[model samples]
Target: MANGVLRPGAVFAGYRIERVLGVGGMGTVYLAAHPRLPRQIALKLLHQNLTSDDYVRSRFELEAEHAARLEHPNVVAVEDRGRDGGQLWIAMRYVAGIDAEKLLSEGPLEPARAVYIITETAEALDYAHELGVLHRDVKPANILLERRGSNRRERVLLADFGIAKALEETTQLTSSGMMVASLPYAAPEAFDNLDPDPRMDVYALGCTLFRLLTGRQPYPGSTLPQLWYGHAQAPIPQPSAVRDGLPVGFDDVILRALAKKPNDRFRSCGELADAAVAALTPVSQLVVPPEPEPQAAPAPEEPTTVEVRTRPVATTPPPSPKERDARLAIASVTTRLSAVQTRAERLEPAFASLKSEFSAQCSADLISNERISSAEIVEAETILTSAVEALDRGDAERALELTRAVRAHLSTAERNVDAVTGRLALLRAVRANPKAKVAEVRFKVHDAQMLALNHGTADQWQAEFDAQLERIDRIAAELSGRHPDYWAYITGLDDVKSHISALVQRMKRERRLR
Candidate 1:
């Protein structure tokens, strides 16, 4: 192995490693060719250090076993797992596209598109939950999006069962002081160290939806303490509050999903996804309006009989062609005016919201080009005014043309406003606390190291490893402090963690030889 990475042409357990797919705290995943088959598989190898630890090894094997039992279309399949040259490995179906986490780098997905991905993930979660399996770690990174065909529509699949547990299993992997779920998306109960359940996954899934909708984590806390505090105490944030133009109903859906109590949340992941779909759907589209009731006939008037008209009542002439044409034009314009009025009324709220958000966003100094949206709104309003004046003047052709222009202008304005809102929201989030995520990821690294320290059963080198861990702890604290560039510290922490993992592996090998 080259620096713990299998080199190209290196065969292990009948699989030939082609290249590294991804590296995690526990292991490295590779795109490997199956010996007996013509297909490629994502082969994940447990770090040599982790394989020497009983708990970590058991958890690795459990991921394959638990995932292999789930046969969901939206769930990634586990092919097999076994030991190869003393390193534990798992083979799974190789998905071709990026995960949802990477997709969010392009910014929040369209509401419909985000909901579609969530819906697919929900089905996969419910499937596993039904089979007595709980994917304790349900975050965007674990949800793979496979874009297919010419249209590039994504096929969403829920993956990474590394921390999943059977319902009947009593083992608590957190015994090692490492949280099974990612901190940003972990449920409140997870911090409480409560028993594992499906609701925990539901809570994580809700957090995922929030991230997808806002391009920000639900809680932007800079420390592990602050993160858990936000989950347990901070009020659930409304998506519309983050990004303007989001449906108000989405707030309710996310609120329920992130409910402090599991029972207070959706009964299942499917229900959560259903609620998201419902939130995206308009109330006007949900049901038909009732027909108006017929008016009751007035009681017959009595004793008011009128005398017959006198003879020689003059006959009236039929309308002239010009008169008829004018009447028809008036009627046609009146109908068009009604339609346009209704359309404008429907858009009025959106325009008002844009105006309000633009005002609020200006104070933040985050959106520099908000003037474009402001000008668009003003121009659209001016066009609408011109359209109304033309209708009042009975210039039907001019009115029709101006009304179409108003609609087109409003359409462009709305699109621009949405773009502005997204940019404003992203900037605001970054300004507030970019280090929260770095803190969260660093906590994971530290937690994993602590877990390893707790499991290092060999006594000869334990004292030396403890001193190294203390040094790492000091370095981790410094990294979490006032760092000018957060990514620099993050990169530093990753290097530190990788070095520690390598040392642990070396210690295990030396102890075994002795």
Candidate 2:
């Protein structure tokens, strides 16, 4: 009924379409049963309109073909790609269970569960990277959680390689000048039209992890432009900062993965995966703590005017060797605590320096006039400096701490830059015209008049205003692209459009638009 339902027995490439599972801008996914294998597979068909565009068709096929070549257990395996009845489709192993987004939306996953999913995904990405495939879109929606049985743990399967780009290889699909990915999860480099790489996947993965822990995307807004600005300017908050009970080490690994610069991130997905695994392990288990002796009770206070004379009591026999060994263990624990304190004191300055440099770079970038500030480059340098200091002092804990701090700073700097750039663009548009003021007054009058006519019900009026605002905003965006100078001259035009669009849509759904 939705255009994807092939008749009950419709067969595509020897598989029968059971039903349509989902549909997107480019195609439809169907649950199909294999003719002889007795297996169910997800079959994706390119939309009819999309196939009319040769570029989209080729890209769709390329993605399927390339993804089919990857054989990792964690990566969803593509079984076949072909056309039937003028419908091009791809068949992949059908994974049963909800996507990561749906699962997280229901509730926060246990920390261990989150770590498990992330680690599995990292391994899958690492494998793809080794094969030279970059999953340009690596958001939570693309990660599927497959639960086979009631007692078995869920398996993480990375899906939707539809936008995956083979590194260093040029394809007709991308050459045709079409944006092939979702903007929300796109890496900063992708925005600059740079070649796709594994680090892009790394940034996306970090964003997904942040969203899972926070119950919201790192940046959320009503509009795409707003979301983009948030991504570009908001700092990555530590998981522990937002949710209580999360381990500090868990925060460190997330921050590291989110490092603005690719070089600053873990050298590879493998490294990141390993770090995640390590973070999930209890620190007490990894590092043995010295055993401390039970504290002795304090002596009772003597009353005033007590007799000064003291009676000698019989002395007990000396402790056995076992007792002596026990005492030695207590001493050892004391020595270990002292050593820990001493090391912490010595490493304090190095850590402080790392933090200072990271902060300074962030500040400079936020205030600078560069078209594109290399926050990643700055972050990478900080990470390297911290790594060197850590190695020099042979303190892994200190090094890890420094790495996390730099990562947090980097995430914040990148977001800030985006926000500032978007706002600056808006401001510039506002300053260019006198008529923009007149347009604002006219729009406000129209809004007020409509409100009065609707019996002063602000909701009804607000709905109308939102629709107009969306239209104006779209027009202004287009104008900004063509006439940057004229954007500032048209005040209230965009705002009016956005507000009106929102209101109208709401009213229409409520049957009040008539």
Candidate 3:
């Protein structure tokens, strides 16, 4: 444990260590095997000395808790975690992939491929935000891409949430006199330590997209202050400016994403992805053809007045039953779509309230969730616009279908907003009386653990333990971050954590006996 590196073949905490996967400021990640299972995992061990620091330990644990809560296909899943000797360790899926930072050595990625990677990463960020988590540190090093296979689409995942924070959490885990987010990718607000928000991630991701597209950082500075100044004060750099033949539209997307004010940026990572996709449309397709010059009016021809005889209006035949039914269906769908739009409008107040409160409190995670709702509303509006266009074109069936889809999107958006507000209410209630909330959450964690242990096989119990840990961790973090004042809550979490360690140890012992 001298340098937090495990020698190959060394067995620790039931994992047979193979070799170092990577090394970083926090610790070293090793490719290791499960003690009783024939599978490998990426095990990360915090540097021994840092583990003794309360802040570092809390941040490391928070990373595991945050990443574990994000059940996203584009996000790395933390499978297990515990302390060994004096170092805290976590086990995660061992992705046979290369980090995006390293991949740059082969030169810039193809524009389409880079956008695809960013889209995937955006999905992971959006999912994390929906669950009230923030990947405070998003950079090329943390963006992982699986080794390519001829028959498979490339897989990209966002990893290393060591600096992540839960929604409305007050602890400044990202700040300990060390730059948690790499300087080049760090947002402007980060330098000022302004309350972190989802826009920070947006800014970082924008920088990342620039890197992948141009094979260089958006702002290259020779020193820390220079980089800080660039992000904080310099004009946003355009990807097209750095790389020849790059789409000009990318410039617009990056400029907005890396805007000086968060308000000027995309509301969520998904929106940024959507814009990036739009940028991929061919310039010719996006351009509007110029109007032809009006032909000169024909020289005044004699106005031959035709007789204006008014004949009796011809009676049109009554509509067929099928036509009448289609008209009725369109009316019904239109009414439903109107109702959906009204519902979304009504929910706007609550959503706005929660967003304002969280933003003022520097709760980036909740703000991001609010943005998710906002994005959903935007999407519903877009669909509604299309529905209107269909109606204009006399496509009643298409219009009806689009209306129904709009309703569904609005419903989903409302549900997401409701969820965010519900979580906010619960967190507020818990903060009202931390002592009592701690006891309640603690009892639940303990009860859940015992129930799992008493009723399942080792593997089942392990799975149960992980599920419960994520549930209770969210409660605990929302109630109070790993603040020293919340020692009781931390201790309760430790008890719940013990269940997993016990199961792992028992499994190893039983395997040896067999």
Candidate 4:
């Protein structure tokens, strides 16, 4: 239990507290160790004052729920959440990298690297939007830049999932009922307190991009209120104006993002990212050896009809043996890479289909039926999403490998559900046999086990389990004097005892599930 303070070595919600990471107006985050796992996690808990407010408590819990639902390569992953000893906490995957706000303190990032970060972040935002989770807080502090090993790739992630929207709804924050976004990044519509829009995220992303490239805000007012008028009426600044060597074309991407009207901004974060990348580095500059221009027919060779073979045309001799081999090698490598990319593109739809399958599977009550856990499905979905991101990043080979893994995972989950279906059918048959040793033995145990694993045994389910147990015991007593026969193999007293004991044990264990 935490008493307005969590000391080192204290345990909260099954995590061993280590040290405080940071404190904010909302709450404090601590570096904590998993009780059963061998990894550390970031434990974010609401402060006591905030916890006392119903809206704040709901917002904190909603943040955990919505953020946990999103599992993308470029989004921070929330591991778990629950209330503990009157304290609400969210456990998240801990990253060892610094946030963009701190990184920019050194200086503006490389132009290429900055674009990469923005692209990845935009991708993450787009994914969350598809999941119906909006990340309203898009700022430098919320974007973390991680290093991708020797490749030196910048792995950017968007954090704080839906906290901003949750905050926006709080009466404490918006007394006038007008919406408030982070001043520097807030879209014009955001100031009008309009309904939440995805374009708001785009607007903030544009501001973050501005800082990433120029190391300064597009509208550098001193305070949130001071920046409001500028956001609504100020001229959009050009990235080129802030930094040297930037193309005037770059202004197109930034100004459109900072557009005063939400409708006038990029329709989606992906569009914004694509436009920025294109403006910064055109495609013509990337594809080299430009497609060979079609050659005109050599002026018909002056209409020469005479016998002129010309020594086999003296055709450039195939460039020399060494040159031919080198060209062959290069061509072969290019062909292989292209093939991999094609295959990746083909498998992308398969991943999307898997997502639909997962959604339908969960909604169909697989977790309630005890066939598989929600965590299992979430893990599969996460892998599929990561594969999509890999494909987007042009890592075709890796994406293809992950797609295969996702296929295998979904297959295993389907098989598990099928097996459970068969078991459930057999149990149903046994439970329906009124003349047997038990009228409700197998089926009742299955129901109890499922309930215990899921929402636990409520008074209603507990009563049901008890009534079924009583009915079974009465039937067993009634069959005590019967002669031993082949029926012993069907709903026998021993079988009844076995299932009863197992269900009881599960019921006890599930008391600690949350």
Candidate 5:
């Protein structure tokens, strides 16, 4: 439903898709589970349209082959592999934590922390190398850190060896004809060599370490050729260059690993880990001193004294009835918003099914992601928390206004979540019956399209929906050429495409009126 993906309830090869973990260079990876097993796993599936590409399909198979041989605790384990309809998929061991990119977004990791993760990942790399598996794609997003366990230690897992094969083989291409990897993290030599080895991974790990320590990629290039020049010819920058007061020892370790020549880098993973332990060791923890007290302003050179004189002035009365009623209405809405937020927060821990439903119906939807900002939501929640504190301190007017502001923010998200539910339900139904009548399916698509437009999805979602439709059209073309038997399926795709296009045009008109 979300860009032609399987619904949460849809099962493929016995694994039920729960939610999307992320979209990767190769495909979308979803959190899934076995129908009878207690454990959850990750399901990596190729996009439905990309299934016909030989290069992409071969790369997927290569990933499966590469990952199946890796059995280390630090590397994500492959549980199963199969083809589901037009998509090829691999079920993997589920690591319950966010990726390094999400973590780094909050801020840079401390030297000690970054070193620990790097070391753990190095161990995984060493293990995979020993097994003759080459993971050329080593980046922050590929490195997953499991939630802290009872021991307060995190477990790290490396992911997506599939992309290592595909991107290195395929030149970046697009309608513009100059598209490149948004942030390619492969080693410098891999760009030309196209062969993987331990040293290649070591170089990538070094670059990943730089990002972890400083919260950004080493080279700030925006274009593919610029990035290529950066990796191949630009001088390697140290981690401490970006982060002040960081241990200087890291300069030696990082620079040597990022040396233009592979032979200049660390000879082995063991050697790299030994150097990291020293480079990452804390000479002293950074203890922030307390904020200084504000000093009173000094008196001017020419001292002036004001003469005390009481003057009669017209006095304003208290708020009139209309003003008072406006305040009361805001207060009432504030209370309602507070109750709704309470219910939402409760879903995080109090109810499992409802929490899952929200993630499925709202969080998993691509439209919701493009329309909403998670950071903004968090900020609004924090403001509401402060507003509640203001109420606790008996500042009724200030609390009422602040809470009302937060209510509007929450309402936007609440509306988005509610609006998608009906549309998504229809999408799920249509996928289940691809052979259904044109009129029957068109009705379902029409209903969903109307709901999307009413909820303001036309202008905001047209570009994304258009791209998805193009993919469907491509798939239809490929399918139609095969035989007469696929004509019905192509017709099904046509109905979906036509309905979506109508919705888009309707949205454009709506936007113009506004």
Candidate 6:
């Protein structure tokens, strides 16, 4: 279907094409197997009609270069690229599973599975954002699910970069009057031709999560224009309203992410992922959600003490009206001061508890690691301090407002901690195991190398890591190290390290480790 040639078993670039996997609007994807290596790959070739256009060829090359730089478990890996005769082709990892849209069509996934997919995708998006790449078109169709092994279910891999925009690039792929279309997953700003950002990806992710839970797109319409209108004017319906047995906080998280204004949405994909995880967790296990307003019952209608002091009243009234007004003002100020002191007394313990929690949750490595910076911690602390001050001033309403901000910041900090801590623990385990198999050791070493590069300064860290990684490559070059097809797992680590090296360099310069 690609070119009315290159059929199954046909050789292209020394790889035999097995069959056509699928045809998209812009290209045809084929299932290809390498001749010498016992591995299968998906080769995507640009449509023949567009090969002659220099603009299309440039955009295709740009996509391959950008996609090749991304190396995350949740992202589909772009392996190699070349021109096959008149057609341009990109070799990508061939995943034997369905895309997310197809998986959703059968029914809603288990709640835990859905959360896992969403969280993993969020991490991938966070990494991409740090490299200044925005996957402007994020939807179920663009997400591929890869099966690992027997009983391993499937892993989510984000795909499609046809419309992705690189923040550093001045040229755009889409024409001036053309509209870049995605399904219901497009954010409000996406429709307005605004440059996409991390928040825009967060908004699309929210829409995707909503669809996963409810088995329906949030804003379904007959036409793209109709959907755009709905996105602009319609309120996001609660998840529970569409389906029963939804989690309590699910609706709120989705609504917040789908906020009309970019500023109203979560600041980053990590924030959205953290909130989604918390929502999916059982209510009994979660810290209770904060109560915004707590009005005290009308203090039992305190009895009025009406002691009739007739002589005192007459003496006071004899004074000038101006003197009486001044006295009233003084009394008001005294009462306000008393209230402030009382509030301070009540909030002292709460402030202490908050500080203790912050210190206990954020470790030194978390603070120093590139994943979560000191600026985020300072922002959270500042907001929490303001909340305490507000409470001390008897402004409970304003205090509650600041508390919400504090909670959002804390959520992001917790996620960054979790991500970095998990990676650190894995590395430590690998380092401690003297009897670790070569495959396992290689995997750990590769991960460690990536972490080092990602957290390193922008000067020569990449070059240093590259030199160290070459040792692994040299080991694979030995004749005695060759192994059977089944034992070829060790070589896979080399491939992973090569890709991750590129990813680390891209991310470190952009400051998007999280």
Which candidate number has the best TM-score? 3
Which has the greatest lDDT?
3
RMSD of each: 20.3, 17.7, 17.1, 18.7, 26.1, 16.2
Model 3: per-residue Cα lDDT over 329-439, one tens digit each: 344333434543454454556556544543334234445555666677788778767865665565667765775576556556655654555545544543455544444
Q: Candidate 3: deviation at residue 275, Å?
A: 0.3
Model 6 TM? 0.55
**Candidate 2, residue 65: lDDT:** 70
Error of 3 at 8 (Å): 1.1
Instruction: List runs of model 4 lying over 4 Å from the truth.
Output: 1-5, 171-181, 282-514
Q: How close is every model to the real structure, measured as TM-score? A: 0.54, 0.55, 0.57, 0.53, 0.52, 0.55
Give candidate 2 regions above 4 Å deviation. Answer: 1-8, 49-51, 164-181, 281-514
Give a tens-digit lDDT track for model 5, residues 429-482.
433443332333343344334445545565676565556556555544454352
The better-scoring model by TM-score among 3 and 6 is: 3
Over all chains combined, what TM-score does candidate 3 have? 0.57
Candidate order by lDDT, decreasing, is 3, 1, 4, 5, 6, 2
Q: In model 3, which runs have C-alpha deviations exceeding 4 angstroms?
A: 1-4, 164-181, 288-514
Overall lDDT per candidate, in order of appearance: 0.65, 0.58, 0.66, 0.62, 0.61, 0.60
TM-score, predicted candidate 4 vs. hidden true structure: 0.53
Residue 429 alpha-carbon offset, candidate 5, angstroms: 55
